[model samples]
Target chain A: MHLERLDFRLQLRALIRKELQQILRDRQLIFLLFAMPILQLFIYGFALSPEVDRLRLGIVDHAGSSISRALAASLVVNGVFEVEESGGTEAQLARKVQDGQLDAGLIIPADLERRYRSGQKTRVQVLIDGVDANTAGIASGYVGQILAAFNRQLTTGTQLPGELVAPQITFAYNPGLISSWFFVPGVIALVLNLVSTLVSSAALVREKDSGTLEQLLMTPVSSLQILLAKIVPLSFLLMITVFVALMVAFLVFHVPFRGNLLLFLFVSFLAILVGISIGIALAAYSENQRQSLLTSFFVNLPVIQLSGAIAPLESMPEIFQWMSLLNPLRYYVSCVRAIILKGVGLEEIWPNVLALAAYALILLSLSSSRFRKQLK
Target chain B: MRRVFSQVTKEIAQFRRDRLTLALAFFLPFVALLLYGYATRLESKNIPVAVKSYDTGTLSRAYIDTLFATNQLVPARFRGSDIMGPLDEGEAKAAIIIPAQFSREVAQGRVADIQVVIDASDVNNARVIKNCVIAAGNYFARSRDIARGRQLIVPQVRLWFNPGRDEALYVAPGAIAVILWIFPCLLAALAMSREKEQGTILQLYVSSITSFELVLGKALAYTLIALAQAVLLIAASMALFGLRLVGDPFMFVLSLVVFLASSVLFGTFAGTRASTQSAAVQLVATTGFTTALLLSGFLYPLRNITYPLSLISNILPARYFVEECRNAFVRGADFASQLYIPLALSSCALFLYLVTSNILRKMQLKG
Candidate 1:
């Protein structure tokens, strides 16, 4: 029994060594393992900001008075709205917006100053393109805020001679509404998913495509040991990437980590497992490297959408909401958001934890079984 | 010429036999289009909100009525002081706290503030909610002003092209760019790398086939397939997502052909450098995928991005394509208006194809 155990240990060491040598030899793989994560970190950290600013505004001022000009000037003061073109006809302004040259148009009626002075309400029109639903919605909101502030200025000290209602707004958690803070958590989920998914499948299928996998199978290692050997090196590389991503999130983006460190680590590992399992399952089913790649794209596109990465779970259509329940990314994304942003513990995020665990279990088992069958 | 024709024919036959590659080439673009179209909805409507009204007064009721009427907020009753319970459970995104003195203060013409506590976990969603809440408050305040026989300045908002502010218009064409980018590039990158990895590239080198003929043959075959996919995606976007082709159809097709040629040329460049399928895949994913997602201005406007990122955006072909698509689809801009973009695109295509062919021919001379 002791000799047999010793023999098993020896075989395991050889398998691991072989895997490591292969990984180190491929300069491209090493680059994928290191440079890709760091590049993505910088890309997402610097490039993508959810905060909408500097929207192009078209103006048509038929009022031709100080009040109408003041409104336009006030809208531009916040730096969120930039006046692209001024003093155009309303139809011309609308055409500019339709042509995608401008995002929004403001139309001040001809009788605006006359009506305001005569104790009659005058409506000023603000038209915005809604093609980009998020930007459109936010632009409209910014317009509202600008209007409310303008109304307050009209009512406050210089005194418009009329009372206006103003809402006292308090933004909980992130008061500044920093786009990076929101993105950091999603970025963590995304970087980890991309690394784990691409690396695990690519590493496994590379061996098969090169015929090294068959030779490795001929050795004393069990099918499970070979599978474990295949994943362990790649997963370790992926874990290093996770650390890199976290460092970038904390140090560069300055995303706050209010939750327990240990819990965050634990949940992240669960997310990594989820990525690896799905990748391996796809790899096992695919006959070649290219097929596996196409499969990965097919799976990843849906996974990203269902994960509530960009489109919130609350916003997706009803059937898609149901589909999101099965997406591991959904649970991981929500869990990380809750942990990082809300600083909630496992008690609050248990559903996501349970779902992630379930995904790992089912995917790991399914892929391993398929792998074993193929080996036989 | 004969060698090139025979090589092209061989490539066409191989492509047909590869069922998986063919399916991915012909079918995946539509699938990706449908998925992205259905998934990306930017309009923030029907936000679940908790109404914590302490005052049972007509003014407070009016405020609540105005909030619901905007169609932005969907009110759910907050059970007493446990407002955080609904918010923590993700049932409500925001809570409107009307203090007990709300009616009294409003009635007496005093500044009565409605406390809007927002869960700003998602910055994008939070902005939408905050704006809606403020708009609702302003609407109520205006009603009060009119009640007192005062003049108010109201703003009327209008949206054009995508008047309904449908996200499909924003996402569908962008999705087409993404789909075209991935499949065609991968197909071309893998075409040559597959030869190398299978040791068939050595056989081609040994045979009488010149390097120019080989590169042109593969490029032509893949370009035709990619062009077909592009057309399918364009048609699918129109039929399903209502993408209006308002510009010159001829110019649109010309721009597409130019864009596809540039992409395939870049793919050939990557394929020639990489000796294995895995390396080629890695190269394409890192360079192609990352550039498309990051530098293409697909997700956000190029102008708002910082100096370095904006500079990077200039080098990527997808940025120009996305811009041209928006102009064509929305503004119906003529060829003269977008002349420089296609010109730049075709020049890049010509340059890359020349470089790739030169490199391959040099290798042929060496062998």
Candidate 2:
């Protein structure tokens, strides 16, 4: 029995060494494993911001008065809108908007200053391009807020007999609202998900495609040991990627790692296992690498979408929100976000931890069974 | 010409034989469409906010009522005096604490301070929460002022193009652009890399067909497949999202053809560059798919993308194609006004085809 155990270890070690050598020899795989995550981290951290700013505003100041100019000036003061072209007719501004050169246009009427001074309610027309419904909504809201502030300034020192409620808003966790802090954790989850599934499945599918799996199966080594040999090395490599990604998030993006280090790694490992299991299942089902990749894409896209990695779960419909409950990545993202951002421990995120663990356990067993069947 | 035609036929035959890939090409986009249409809502709605009212008075209750009245925030249950507990536990995104003024300060015409603590982990969602809560506060204050008779400058705002602000109108076209770019590029890249991997490109090298003919043949075949994908996706979008062509159909059709050709050529370029199918897939995913999704102004506006990255978007064909798709579907502007979009798309197609053919010609020479 001791000799059999020794033999098993020798075989597993050999398989792992072979896998590592193959991975190192493939420059593209090495790049995909290490470099892609950091590159994606930088791109997503810097470029992907939902905070709307610097909209191109076309001004048609027909009034040509100080108040009208002051109104347009106020919109530009906050850097929300930059006056691309000023002192044009409303028709000209509309044409610019139609041509997609401008995001919105503010038309100041000829009597705007006159009407305001005479205490008659003045109306200004703000035309917004609503093709991007999100930006357009935010722009209109911003215009409303600016106009409200302007109105408050105009109506200041006037005697009004009413109560005022002041809401003192304080942003916790991330006071500065650094978008990268929000995205980096999510991107880390996304990169890990993509790499784990694609690399693991491709590794297995390549073996199957080249008829090497059959060669390996003819050996005395158990299929379980073979699968373990494959999974262990891949997981070790993926964990290193996680470390690299986390370092980038910390050093470059300044994303705070507020929770327990061990807990975070454990959860991340669970998430990676979930990804690998799904990949192995896909590899076992697919006959070739091409089909494996296409199938992985088919699986990965919805997983990423429903994970609340890119878009928030609160924003999704009720059905999708409930559906996200079934997504393992959702639990991972929630845990990661809580740990990194909110500085919560396992106590706070135990449910997510449990869910992730369950997924890892269930998927690992299922995929291993399928893999063993395929080997036989 | 006959060589190119025969090559096209050969590719289509292989593609048809791969029933799995053929089904996925049609089905995956439909899944993406459904997900993008329903799942990708940037607008934060029904954010859970834990409201801790220390004052059980009428005014505080009314203030709480006013907060939830907009339906942007809903009350979340939290235990004890720990205001941050719910937020920390991920049960609520924000917490509202009403101090024990007993409505005395507000009744006395003083500003009643309500402390609002928000989880700004998601900066975008936090911004929405802050805006919603402040708006609710402002409304409450303004209504009181209005009770005493006061009016300010009321700006009449008009939402042009998409007045209803339907999200599907914006998302469906962008989804089409993204789906079209990713799948076709992926398919073509795989096709090219498969030949290289299987050592079949040597046959092409020995054949009388010129490098240009081989590239064109492959591109034409994939372009036809991509065209079918476009038709199916467009038809699906219309059926699913109730989308109709609002602008010049001819401009839309022209841009779609140009965009598909560019995407397919791009795939072939990556395939030719990468030695392995995995490498090609990686190339397409990292460059083609991510850029098409992010920098193409599919989810975020182009203006919102910061500098340096914005420069990358300028060269991306997907960006221009998405613009044209949105124009055709939502804005419905005059064809003349949006003429530069198709021009830019066609230029991109021409550039990609030229670069791909150059790569193929060099490969042929080396062989």
Candidate 3:
């Protein structure tokens, strides 16, 4: 029995060494496994922001009064809108907007200063290109706020009752509201998913396509042992990716790591396990590398979308909100965000941790069972 | 030309035999359309805000009522005086604390201050929350003033193009662009690399088919497949999201054809460069998928992308295609005004085709 155990150890070690060598020898795979994640990290961190700014504005100041100029000036002062054209008819402004030269046009009427001086309510027309709905909504909101503030300034000290209620806003966790702090954690989850699932499934499918799995099965190693060997090395490599990504998030993006380091690593390890199991299940279901890749893409896209990695969960409809509960990546993202940004402990993130652990266990068991059956 | 046609027929035969690829080619785009249309809501709603009021006065209650009236910020329940509890526990995205004597101060004609603490971990959501809270406050004050019968300057806002702010109208066109680019590029790349991976390119090297004919053959087959994909996705968008062709269909169709050809040829180029199917797919995924999704102005506007990155976006075919699609579906601009998009698309297609053929010729010479 002692000799048998020793032999088992020897076989497992050999299998792991072989897997490592195969992975390391592929220069392209190594680049993809390591460099791509960092590259994507920087690109997404810098490029992706929902904050709307620098919209092109066209002003048709028919009034040509100081108030009209001040109103138009206020819009550009905040840098939300840039004055692209200041002197044009409303028709010309509309034409420019249609030609995609301007994002919005503000028309000040001819009687603007006269109406205001006479204490009669004045009306100004603001035409916004609403093809991009989100930007238009935000721009309109800005216009509303600016107009309200302008009204207050116009009516000040004239028995116009002051605002009875005011809100003092304070942003917690990230005082500056850095977008990268939010995106980096999500990117970490994304990178982990890509490496663990795509690479592992491709590795396995490539073996099956080359008929190496059958040859390996001809040996004395158990199917479970072979699977373990493949998973162990892949998980080690994925951990390195997670580490490098975390470093980039810290050094480059200045993403604060507030939670316990050990806890973050543990959660990431579970996430990697979940990813590898998903890849294994995909490999078991596909006949070739192409099919596996296509299937993975089909599966990964929805999972990533529903995970709230890019889009927020509260904004989704109720059904999808509930459906996101089933996605394991959701838990990973929540845990990472809570740990890194909120600096919450296991006590706060226990539910997410439990969910991730359950997913890792269940998926690993189901995929390994299917894989073992296929091997037999 | 006849050799290219026969090669196309051979490639189609191979494509049809792969039932999974065939199903994926048709089904994946449909799924992506559904997901992007329904699941992605840039307009944030139903943000949970914990409202902790220290006063039980009618004015404070009315203020709280007005806050939740918009339904943009929903009230979250919390048990304690700790305003930060719900935020830390992730139960609420923000917290509103109404100080004591708030209603009295307002009744005494002094301004009442309400403290709002927001979790800015998600910066965009935090910004939305801040705006919602402030808007609610402004609404409260404005309504009070209106009750008192005061005149105010009103801005008549007109939302042109998409007056209803229908998110699907904005999202669907971008989705179609991204879906078309990713799948065709992926399919073409895989098809190109599969021959090299299996050592079947050697046969082509020995055959009488010129390198141009071979590349043209593969490009034609995949473009045909992508054309079908484009039709199915556009139809699905129309049915699912109530998307309609708002302008002349000529520019949209012409640009779409060139766009698909360019994407497929781009894939073919990547396939020529990468020696294996996985490598080609990876190449497409990392470059093709990422750029098409991010830089193509799919979710965020092109203006949001800063310099250097914006420069990269200028070269991406998906960016121009997305612009043309948005114009076709939403803006309904004139055909002459939108002519530059198709021209840009054709130039991209020509460049990709030339590069792909050149690479194929080089491979033949080496062989």
Per lDDT, the best of the predicted structures is: 3
lDDT over C-alpha atoms for residue B229 of model 3: 97
Interface RMSD of each: 2.7, 2.1, 1.9
Enumerate the candidates' DockQ scores in order: 0.56, 0.68, 0.69
After superposition, the stretches of candidate 1 with alpha carbons farther than 4 Å from their true spots are A1-14, A86-95, A107-116, A120-125, A151-165, B1-4, B76-85, B147-152, B202-213
- DockQ winner among the candidates? 3
Query: After superposition, which runs of candidate 3 have C-alpha atoms over 4 Å from their true positions?
Result: A159-162, B79-81, B146-151, B365-367
Measured with DockQ on alpha carbons, how good is candidate 3?
Answer: 0.69
Candidate RMSDs in Å, in order, are 2.9, 2.0, 1.9
For each candidate, give its TM-score against the true structure: 0.92, 0.96, 0.97
**Candidate 3 clashes between residue pairs 3 or more apart in a chain or in different chains:** none
- Misplaced by over 4 Å in model 2 are A159-163, B147-149, B365-367
TM-score of chain A of 2: 0.94
lDDT of each: 0.78, 0.87, 0.87
How should the candidates be ordered by DockQ, best one leading?
3, 2, 1
lDDT of 3 by residue, B212-281 (tens): 8999999999999999999999988888888889877988889999999999999999999988887898
Give one digit per residue, the lDDT tens place, for model 2 in B200-276.
99889877888889999999999999999999999989998988898889999999998999999999999999887
Worst 10 residues of 1 chain B by lDDT: B145-154
